[model samples]
Target: MNFLSPLTEGLRGLGRAVLFLFTILAGIPAALLRPRLILQQIYSVGVLSLIIIVISGSFIGMVLALQGYRTLVNFGAASSLGVLVALSIVRELGPVVTALLFAGRAGSALAAEIGLMKATDQLSGMEMMAVDPIKRVIAPRFIAGLVAMPLLVSIFSLMAIGVAGGHAIGVELLGVDDGSYWSQINQAMHGTDIRDMLIKGTVFGLAISWIAVYQGYHAAPTSEGVSRATTSTVVVSSLAVLALDFVLTAFMFH
Candidate 1:
């Protein structure tokens, strides 16, 4: 009976999460009608996340270019480095890394903010005023995350492209042929890669937002509980991002 209790609780929680998701989705149209709310959250979650994404993308791109250059040079295929780097960024690293970062930054922030709101009885105050907190608060944040993710992934990939990404190190520093670099990328990269990136970004955004908001919404109205929910948001959102990336990669690439 004791063992079954945990399983039952997990199942019950899953059910609640699904229901909560539906409620948010139902409110999204209304939230969209109030684009200002969504825009505010976009600034909160998306714009604020750019510094980390840019810095991380730069480092990742530089490292990948350096390592790939060494290995490809051994094979006398150094010219293909640009194609390798671009494909890697567009297909895998861009969306996945951005999502992990988003989970850590925006996702945890969303959970903590909402949890604090709940703890402070702000949500209850809305109810007392006959307002739907779900419509006013959660849905806008969810929509903002959903809209901002693909944009963030695009920015991150751009960072990996020329600014501080592979091009800076692969071409200028490593003496790779400039024409071969861009031309190879033009030839090898395809529309499917872009499609895959956008799809993964959108899906990951939805999943991360759902987990963050749900955890916060249900958090016990206490300081410790809000803190736990915030921690859980980061942990669960990260695991979910990795798992979903694997699934998405297998489905899209394989």
Candidate 2:
């Protein structure tokens, strides 16, 4: 009981911190009326994330097709390759993988940048000048992350499908029917899966950006503190993505 108390308290603190940051982000409109911030967010979150998501998505799809084909062949069921690839990539792999990549790329950078600013007392200087740090700094990043994640995930899903389709054509060298491949994929992709992917991407994006900024804002006032905060940001955000994935899966599927 004594040991569990610390864990519970820590979780409670984390929850409160997240809620506070989210509340600030949500209230940005009334505080800061800048259209440029939205454009910046779109560029930072969406445009910058395209290359990584595309490369990762394409390779993952190819690998999945290769692996799935080999496994299904062992059971004399090779014709179902398209269904398996599409279902796995769209329903699960697309959103989760893209989000994890986004977290590692953009999330870490956001944390380090904010942590550095805080360590240098720039944030305090802004506050002394009557600037609202939430409006000027946090809100833009939060909105950018939220908007960019879904766009990146959708691109990833599309690229992955393209890669998988090419891989399927190559698999026909082993006598798999080309006509049956696309048909199986069409059958497997339900409308609900698309909605689930979008929802999961949005949730993951919000979690990653929120955690990154929160860690940066709360970091200790030292170089080592900034480093620790950056590390914590990446680790915590990745774990949160996975945990939320499970929760979403259960809720959406059950």
Candidate 3:
């Protein structure tokens, strides 16, 4: 029992830390009203994330098509491959997987950069110079992340669909008709599914960027601390995306 006490205590502390971060992020709206920060945030989250999203999305679609076609063919349901590929990529796998990759690539970078700024007191200096750090730093990041994620996800979804289409035409060996494939894709996609994916992407973006900034802001004032904060931001953001996915799925689908 004594040995278990330390583990329990550590868990409690971690929970409290996470809770505190949520409270701070929830309060970010107060800082988001500044115009300068909003533009910067838009650039950081939206513009920067585009390349990675496009590249990853294209490949994911191709891979999904390749794998999904194999499975469907085994069951002699190869004609429905487009429907399954589109739905899985657009509604579920696309947003979640892209977000996870984004978190690993960009989320950690954001955290480390911000953590370094915090450690070096650069953030404090901004405050001293009549800059609201939240407005200047956190607000843009939050807004950028929120705005960029959906756009990136949307781009990813489109590219993935394209790639899947190409793969089906070339590699699936399914002999599926082109018109049939597109018809199935169109039938399977609904306005609601699009809305759901966009919502999920937006929320994921906000959560990931917020986690990175929050971790950076609260990191220990040392280089080692910044490294740890960066790593933690990626891990926590990825887990949060999965957790939120389940919650959103229950609400949207169930």
Candidate 4:
């Protein structure tokens, strides 16, 4: 009975999470009609997240180039480096790394913002004023996250593929033929490849953002509670991104 308690609780939590997600999605249509609010949220979620994405993407691409180059050199197929780097950055690293960073940066921020609101009784205050916090507050942030994620992922992939993969390592360090580098990338990468990556980004964005808002909205109205919710937001969002990436990869590729 004790062991079953934990399992039952887990199932209950999962159910609540699903219901919470639907509630947020339900509010999104109202948010879409308010472009001004959505734009502000986009700036908050998307623009604010750019610096971390760019820096992380650059370093990750460089590291992949360095490691990939060593491996390919042994095979005497170093020119294939471009395709390798492209596939990695475009298909995997770009979306996964961007989502993780977004979880830490934007996801954490969303949770903290909402959690703080709860802790301060702002949500209750809205209720007293005949306002629904879900529509006014959470919906715009949710919409913004959905809008921002794809753009952020695309920029991250481009910066990684262009500067780190193409220029820095491929051109400067390894002396890979610039023409061949780009040519192989063009040959190996197809529309489906890009489509798959974007799909992952979209799904990840929805999941991470949804988790953040739910955690915040349901957090206990205490300082410690808010802090705990914020931490959980980051941890859960990161794990969700990784897990989703695996499932998405399996379905998309294999």
TM-score of each: 0.98, 0.89, 0.85, 0.97
lDDT of 1 by residue, 1-254 (tens): 79899999989989999999999999998898999999999999999999999999898889989999999999999999999999999999999999999999999999999999999999999999999999999999999999999999998998887688899999999999989989999999999889899999999999999999999999999999999999999998989999999999899867
Q: Weakest 10 consecutive residues, lDDT, candidate 1?
A: 158-167
Q: Kindly report which residue stretches of model 2 are placed more than 4 angstroms away from their true locations once superposed.
A: 1-5, 163-179
In terms of lDDT, the poorest run of 10 residues in model 3 is 163-172
Candidates 1 and 2: which is better by lDDT? 1
Candidate 3: misplaced stretches above 4 Å? 1-36, 163-175
Off by over 4 Å in 1: none
Encode model 3's per-residue lDDT on 49-158: one tens digit a residue. Answer: 77777787777777777788788889987767778778988898879987897888778878888899998999999989987776567656766677778888888888
The pairs that clash in candidate 3 are 41-140, 41-144
Strongest candidate by lDDT: 1
**The candidate that achieves the highest TM-score relative to the unseen native structure:** 1
Ranking by TM-score: 1, 4, 2, 3
The models' CA-based lDDT, in order, is 0.94, 0.83, 0.79, 0.89
**Stronger candidate by TM-score (2 vs 3):** 2
Q: How far off is residue 97 in model 4, in Å?
A: 0.9
